[model samples]
Target: MLTVALPKGALLKDSIRLLQSVGLDFSAFLDSGNRQLQIQDPTQTAQGLLVRAQDVPVYVEYGQAQLGIVGFDVLQEKKPQVAQFADLGFGHCRMSVAVPSQSPYRSAMELPPNCRVASKFVHCAHDFFSKIDLPVEIIPLYGSVELGPITGMSEAIVDLVSTGRTLKENGLIELDCLYDSTARLIAHPLSYRLNQYNLEHWLNEISKNSQPLAAKAS
Candidate 1:
């Protein structure tokens, strides 16, 4: 049976909607109060596994799932070994550097050498700082990265910003955007080769549906 991993957070609803367009009804998983991670489709041709957004890639890479839907941020941060099949185009956001609005640091370069930078995405932050030649200390935080600047734990933060509202509420402002991200469809390479016909057909259908939605969103 074909298996797909779906992230459980922001992208979940849209992911289910997209899959339903391709004849996969995942509503039971969404509606059921069941805490079970794996849900079987009535047809039994495919199954859906609910997982952490960050772990979706891990499942696909390990062949635990034939396909997975997750955000580009996780792909960038994890750098997992998998073939990215389609940009699902939902869950849009950007990874950015932000600091307290009143801070003197106006740009990436303006940050003093070796200043502490906090983020859940340590590798992404490291690469970005390296490219800009701004040497810094990395202080990893699990959640609420906005607290980094507020508490003086770090001079700046690298985190996903969906809207400016969270930053504004925290008295922080975006310093520079690192990357624009959206959810994407990813597949294990071997699984794609083995299920080539069905997977390609599925992807093409989703892409066709996505164009209109993208236009509407724009």
Candidate 2:
């Protein structure tokens, strides 16, 4: 059976919806009491594996799952061996460089060399700074990076920002957007090549249905 790695957080609902559109049903994951990590479509055509958003690619790359739904940020951070097949276009956000609103640095480039920047995404942060030839100490922080600047543990932070609200509440401001992120459909490289479980047909269907929704003009 075709097995999919479904993300367990914010993107889960839409990922399930997209799969449903293509004729797979893993809706049991939505029930408040449904704690099962693995589920099967009623039709027995496929199965779903609920996993951490960051671990989606890991499962797919290891061949435990033929496909996965995950954020672009995770793909970049993990650098897993998988095929990035489609931009599913949900869970939109950005990777940014931010600092305290009152900080002297107004832009990423202006930050002093060896400045400390805390982030859960150390690799992404390092790559961003390297492009500008700015050497920084990227503190690997796995939780609440905004506190880095507020607590004086770091001069800045490299983190994902969905809205400026969190930063504002913490007296932080975004200095630069490194990249925009969205949910993407990824597959195991060998599985994709082998056309395992006839994955291509479902991929085409999902691709046709999940284009980024258009914003209605006022």
Candidate 3:
């Protein structure tokens, strides 16, 4: 059976909706009382695995799932060896450098070299700094990265910003936007190449029913 890895948070509903448009319904994952991490589509053509957004690529790369849905940010941070197929176009957000509102630094470059920048997306943070030729310490903060700057533990934070509500509430200001992120379709290369379990047919159906890559979906 073709197994799909579905992200568990904000993107869940949209992902299920996208799959439904292509004739696979995994909406059971969205039920308020549903507890099963793994659910088979009612049609018996495929199954879904509910997992953290960050782990979607991991499952696909390892062949535990032949296909997955995850945010572009997670793919950049994890860099798992999966074939990136399409951007599902929901979950709009951006990865940004943020600092305390009163901080002297106005941009990522203004921060002193080697200053501590906290984030859960350390890899993405590191690459951004490296591209700009800035040297800084990337602190890995799994929970509440805004605290890094708030508590004076770090000079800034590299994290996702959606609508800027959280940043505004915390008195943090965006210094620079690293990149925008959205949900994307990823597939295991081998499974995709072999078209196992009629995977190509499903993908074709999805492609026809959904927007093409890089096109935003409502």
Candidate 4:
């Protein structure tokens, strides 16, 4: 069976919808009482694995799943060896460098060397600063990065911003955006190259159904 790794948070609803459009229903993951992490489509043609967004690529890369739907940010952070099939395009956000509104630094480049930058996405944060030739300590904080700046633990934070509401509420402001993020369909490299489970056909169907939606989103 073709197994898919579906992210378990904000992107889950749209991911399920996209799969539904391609005639694979995984909406049982949405039911309040459905606690099962693994589920089969009505036809049993495929199965869906509910996992953390960060684990989507892991499952696909290891062949535990032949396909997955995850955010671009997680892919950027993890840099998993998976074939990026399509931009499913529902979860839209940006990876940004933010600081206290009153902070002297206005841009990522302006932060002093050795200064602290907190983030759950340490890899993304480190890469962004490195490409800019800025040397700083990337402190990994998996929860509420905004507090990094507010509490003086760090001068800035690297995190995802949707409407910027969380940043505003915390008296933080965006200085630079590393990149915009959206959900993307990924596949195991070998599975994709080998055409496992007739993956190519489903990929084509998904791409056809997905392109118009992605275009609309763009």
Clashes of each: 0, 0, 0, 0
* Model 1 misplacement above 4 A: none
* Predicted candidate 3 versus true structure: per-residue lDDT over 1-218, tens digit per residue: 99999998988888898899887899988889998999899999899999998889989999999999899999999899999887677888999999999989998989999999999999999999999999999999889999998888999999999999999999999999999999888999999999999888877776655575336444
Per-residue alpha-carbon lDDT of candidate 1 for residues 89-205, written as tens digits (9 for 90 to 100): 788899999999999988878999999999999999999999999899999999999999898889999999997899999999888999999889898898788774377666677
Number of the top-ranking candidate, with TM-score as the measure:
4
Name the TM-score of candidate 3. Answer: 0.95
As for candidate 1, its clashing pairs are none
List model 4 lDDT by residue over 1-218, tens digit each: 99999999999998899899999999999999998999999999999999999999999999999999999999999999999988887899999999999989888889999999999999999999999999999999989999998889999999999999999999999999999999998999899889999999988888788887888988
- Could you say which candidate leads in lDDT? 4
Model 1 lDDT-worst window of ten: 209-218
**TM-score of every model versus the real structure:** 0.95, 0.96, 0.95, 0.98
lDDT by residue for model 2 (1-218), tens: 89999999999998999888888999999999998999999999999999999989989999999999999999888888899988887888999999998988889999999999999999999999999999999999989999898889999999999977999999998999999898899999898888889988877777777864312110
Show the lowest summed lDDT stretch of 10 residues, model 3: 209-218
Query: After best superposition, candidate 1 residue 142: deviation in angstroms?
Result: 0.3
* RMSD per model, one decimal: 1.4, 1.8, 1.6, 0.8
Model 2: residue 17 alpha-carbon error in angstroms:
0.9
